[model samples]
Target chain A: MEFRDAWAIASKDLRIELRSRILTNQIAPYTLLILVLFGFALDADTQTLRDTGPGLFWVAVLLIALLAIQRAVKIEDDDAAKERMLLTPVHSSSVFLGKAIALFIQLFVLEILLFFVMLALFDLSVEDPLLICVSAVLATIGVASSGTLYGVIAAGVGVRETLLPILLLPVLAPIAIGATRTFGDAFGRVDADGWAWFGLLSVFAVVYTVLGMLAYGQLMEDA
Target chain B: MNDVIDLQEAVVTLGQFPALTGVTLKVSQGEIVTVCGPNGAGKSTLLRLCAGLLPLREGSAHILGEDLQKNRRIIRQDVGLLGHRSGLYDDLTVEENVAFWGQMVRAESNEINEAIKLLGLDGRLRKVLVRQLSAGQRRRTSLAGLVVQRPLLWLLDEPHAALDSDGRDLVDGLIHEAAASGATIVLASHAPKDISSPSGRFVTLAGGRVTNDINNDGSGDGVS
Candidate 1:
């Protein structure tokens, strides 16, 4: 696939998202709501919240990532639009990569907002900003790649709403663990090995990306 | 003329229900073939099969000189399908939708502009969002995109739906023009009057099989 073709798909999706304001109006606010709900569920204990902030942040991300994937798929809800995309000469893998790239951008922005919210609400402080940033970037790629692959897999089913999370969450569990552990080390909350966790997240990112490219063409037809 | 679409006893199943049962069809290059049938008679399935969207479950299917089973992806690039849906992004303006599809097909900018102009969408409507346009307008935008791609095979499912008399005529003209330029067309429609071109062939499908195959001269065969 030509890189230009993939970027065109990605840019079109991102442009639509920007014009529609779905990400800003609905998804971002939903992520903020999740943080607040987490605060209430944890009983307003700043110490406890701070201790578990990284884990909770990732949890929030995982939940909101579902919304992002759904929105991405929804844009192609008109059957002919998807058929048109499939009929294009661009490789099917390019379509998958394009959507994954768009999702990664949305999630990255959401993470930044959530990170600030955590700092303000949970009184969390970052001890190693660079490490936290790197972990977030790597983990976001992992989430986006797996999320796009599963999103398309469940796109044809009537129970896609219930099925996407079931299919995606288990695949993303390793990402959650690795991201949380690395974030913990970045926050100076644990003496755990940070590079190893970052490495694990990186591996998840690369593996899922490669798998998505190889599997998307078959999935697009089968689904 | 070369055969662009050749399906010999092609069978397609949707779930357990057979949508196309041992269907044989041949469309030559630059020929215009219209499929007429009631709902559930598998007219749409025939178009999808030619576009390589539907898998051939039992028999041979070839389109644009490529075997459907082996070269579906490559065949898709040369084929353009316009189904029931308009396929335009609601959030994007008419121009943007056409430009987006043009980029996907790697069409030249002049060709894109020419297509949009040919569809008569070059005025203020070009800047209007697709969602805000009437159904006829949306259909025109989709046809413009199809025109820009300049596909070898055109599979249109109800190509005249939701269009005014003028828009319908425009579609017919486009079909005739495309066929004159050596582009094969297979369209499904309920209205026979809409596709009354003298050079066109008509095939009626019923119960997943061809019921009537009539030529422009009105001499043909009937299956049942």
Candidate 2:
């Protein structure tokens, strides 16, 4: 029943996003533009871009994740839909899982887009494509879970847009670090242990997912 | 004969200013009660309290046999609250919105369809997005969502606002029908007489408290 409710919510959110085209029309373009500009900032230096591409890719992903989280929270706030949903029999944990699932799907797709863009622009290549995929999935899960939790926490405040980044960015630092190092190993940009960083990413994802499922109900009540 | 709502000296504060102060009221099942008040009289707050959306700062509240302080969240599924906003997703069509909310409450597909038709949201309007809807249509859509829930308690704040004459009549019929079917209703409105049924109770509120609780049975007896 919980999974059913979560799927219902996820499908609802995805449907709305499909209709709105905000992800394709607005946020995607915005993140891609940021990535392109970073290439210019490096003066189109091949070695420089290649060496920094992984970090830059994660940065773009984080920005996109932030926008995605805000958009998720705004949809609920637009018509007091969250409050309305609360009155239903669906559990708040279901709501949290549903939203996180939706976010994960969206962020994963964008990460793929951003990855190919990095490949083309930064002259990047992957030594271990599977590791790259694993890192992306883990990092995306971490972002979605933690971002969903913090999104609701900051939702009730008036200054959420400015406040969200401040609250979300610092917490996402470990993801940025872990995913970057993992990606670096995949790209052969550095010789560090990518699987070790993958371990950290996995822990982050598991911890946040469990915490979100447990705490979402209380956070929503206060939010 | 059981009391569906029993609030005693309930104080609900919104950022330090008490929205509901010392409000004592009792509502039984199968009753249609209209609460009339000026702006900022806590009419909305009272309904929210009964809906278990607001916590009591002082005193006690029990809605549908559940102590609010002990378990407000548990009563939510059985309580329906319609506030000033339509609470319908603008991006979703009328039919989609109704179906979405209905599915949330595990309502049957037939119930969802029936509610849509009952609220006049079938036909072309069913596919129309809520954002494109007029104020009246949106209210009807919201009402359809509420109907699908089939809640034990209906807390409507300004239920007649933004509705046309026919829409208002439709709402009145629904409210009466709901009361007749044993669902307790507490509606707050500015023009209480406009929607007040002959058998309904009229409660006037001011300054976060009830000033008059009177029966419409022509007894002229009021509890102040």
Candidate 3:
């Protein structure tokens, strides 16, 4: 029942997102624009661009994930859909899982697109393709779980737009640093143990995922 | 007779302002109770409290035999609340919104389809997104969603607002039908005469308290 409820909520959110085209027309374009602007800022300095590619890639993903989280929050807040859901038999943890699943799907897809863009614009190539894939998977989960949790926390506040970044970015520093280091190793730019950083990303994903499930019920009631 | 709602001197504060102050009301099963009041008279707050969405700072509330102070969350599944907003997702089609909400309570496919048709949303409007719907259409869709829940207690706030005459009549009919089927309804409306039937009772609110409660049929005390 819990799994079904989670899927129902996730499907509803994904359907709304697809129909609205906010991710495609607005968020996706905006993310690509950030990368394009970065490309221009670097002035075609191939070595510098290649060296900083991993950091820039994760940075873009983190920034874009914020937009995606805000969009997720708005879909519920608008029209009082959240209140209606509160009246349903669905568990609050199910709601959190559903939202996190939707965010995971979206961020994973966005990361794929950003990866290709990094390859093309930054002239970056993958040496350990397996490491890159694993890093992206783990990092996306970590971001989506943590982002969905923080998104709802900020949503209850009147000044959500300004509050989300202030609350989220600091918490996501580990994902930023860990993903960047792992990606740098995957890109053969750094001579570090990528699996060691991958372990950190894995732990972050599990911790936040569990925390979100436990804390969501209380947070949703307050929200 | 089973008491569906037994609230006594319930005080609910939103931030600093007291929204519901000393509101004592009781509603029995299969009763159609209409709450009437001006703005800020605590009508909506009363409905929300009955729906188990608010905590009482003072006094007591028991809905569907569950003490709200002990467990307001558990009673929510059996309670349906249709607030000022339709609670419909704007980007979703009418059919999608109704079906999604219906599925939340595990409403059968037949129940969902029946609700959509009953609300007059089965044909062209079914595919139209709620954002594109007129106010009346959205209200009808919202009503359909509520009906699909098949809740024990219906908490409707301004259920007739933005509805056309036919839509209003449809809601009135639904409320009567729900009451006849043993469902308790506590609806708050400014225009009470339109929604409350001859047998329904009217409970007036003023300054966060019940000013008067009388049966429209002028027979028994409103509680019974």
Candidate 4:
């Protein structure tokens, strides 16, 4: 309801992510390394890289984004977080917004790194790098919103480690699928109706963002 | 202005479990009331019900003369809360944490700065990450967060549970300030010994029911 509170809470999370850059930055090199390994493991074939590059890019983004999401939720995992944040004066939705912002920033940075890797490894002269950036941004928003929601629910479960990825896959599988379509359409010789996929991604972002803002007030109280 | 929170024999349930039942209480403007009891006494549940964190399965809950179910956004903004946890990010600076809450409540730009100064957090040392600070500092940030909202109602659950003497003093001072500012406070606490003041009224709960109510006359701090 209060717009001021939402921005402030979101900024708080962003500031923390900046200060603890080590936590979010850990994924960048690993993600890059995976892409490089894919290039080397595939016998340096250009056609194969083009065929699988889009899929590889989205998969790397998902896994890297997962690293940041887990760390963001874990920031409130200890007893001190319960004493401090779960009961603080700020709205619970504010907390979720702040963490989601942190997740988005982390994913955006990874996407940039992937751009360079795509050029260097595959020598893929894809037009409109910024278009992929735009698609990545929308896709990142979806990932952050969904991941944070599930992370909160599974924070205390017995099989939290196993439960998180398994539970998230079905909900987020479409992100990888849709994002790959968008990326391929931006540059590849694909003729599938990618605008519909982009539209679906946008709708997902709006719907989930609304659902999170509304339901989060209840979840934070119990957490 | 009338009763900030009015409950008429309200009952709340979680699925098949009973969290609150047949409970009636009134919180008016400019009042501080403590809900004290052992664990599972539903003291926290009572606070949640007043804050509209749970749906009322029986009776009714009204805030500022409006039904809680119909006017939740208004009531939530009017109510400030701090649960057992510190509810802070160790990585965020004290000022950042304060500013975050300030933004949520749409406080004036100076409100965050003033709260930081009021809490004695002006030095560059205060700009460091919360995780790097001491436990006392974290609690200070958490309390400063409430200052940003300055809500009409403050619902705290065991807010003083893990603090040292200084942290306890900080919380005590904040409560006094909120009460002085005409805020209605309903705080739930299991520990009775920490609170030595004899100003506000104290209500004790046992097995999910209010069993005793008495004014603090400096005669006794323990309700039961």
lDDT of 2 by residue, A58-104 (tens): 99999999999999999999889988988998988899999999999
Sort by DockQ, best first. Answer: 3, 2, 1, 4
- Per-model lDDT: 0.90, 0.93, 0.91, 0.73
Top-down lDDT ranking = 2, 3, 1, 4
**Please, what is the TM-score per model?**
0.98, 0.99, 0.98, 0.80
Q: Against the true structure, candidate 4 has what lDDT?
A: 0.73
Candidate 4 residues lying further than 4 Å off, grouped into runs, are A1-9, A22-24, A40-46, A71-102, A127-168, A171-175, A185-223, B14-16, B164-167, B191-199, B218-224
RMSD of each: 1.2, 1.0, 1.6, 4.3
Error of 3 at A223 (Å): 0.8
Best by DockQ: 3
lDDT of 3 at B16: 92
The candidates score, on chain A by TM-score, as follows: 0.97, 0.99, 0.98, 0.89
- DockQ of candidate 3 (2 decimals): 0.87
| Model 4 Cα shift for residue A58 (angstroms) | 1.7
lDDT of 1 by residue, B91-153 (tens): 999999999999999999999899989999998988998889998899999999999999999
Query: Interface RMSD for every prediction, one decimal?
Result: 1.2, 0.8, 0.7, 4.5
Q: Which stretches of candidate 2 lie over 4 Å from their true place?
A: none
* Tens digit of per-residue lDDT, candidate 1, span A1-223: 6778778888988999999999899999999999999999999999889888899999999999999999888888753588888788889889999999999999999999999998899988889898899999999999999999999999888788899999999999999999999998988887888889999999999999999999998998877
How close to the true structure is residue A204 of candidate 3, measured as C-alpha lDDT? 100
For residue A11, give model 2's deviation from the true position in Å. Answer: 0.8
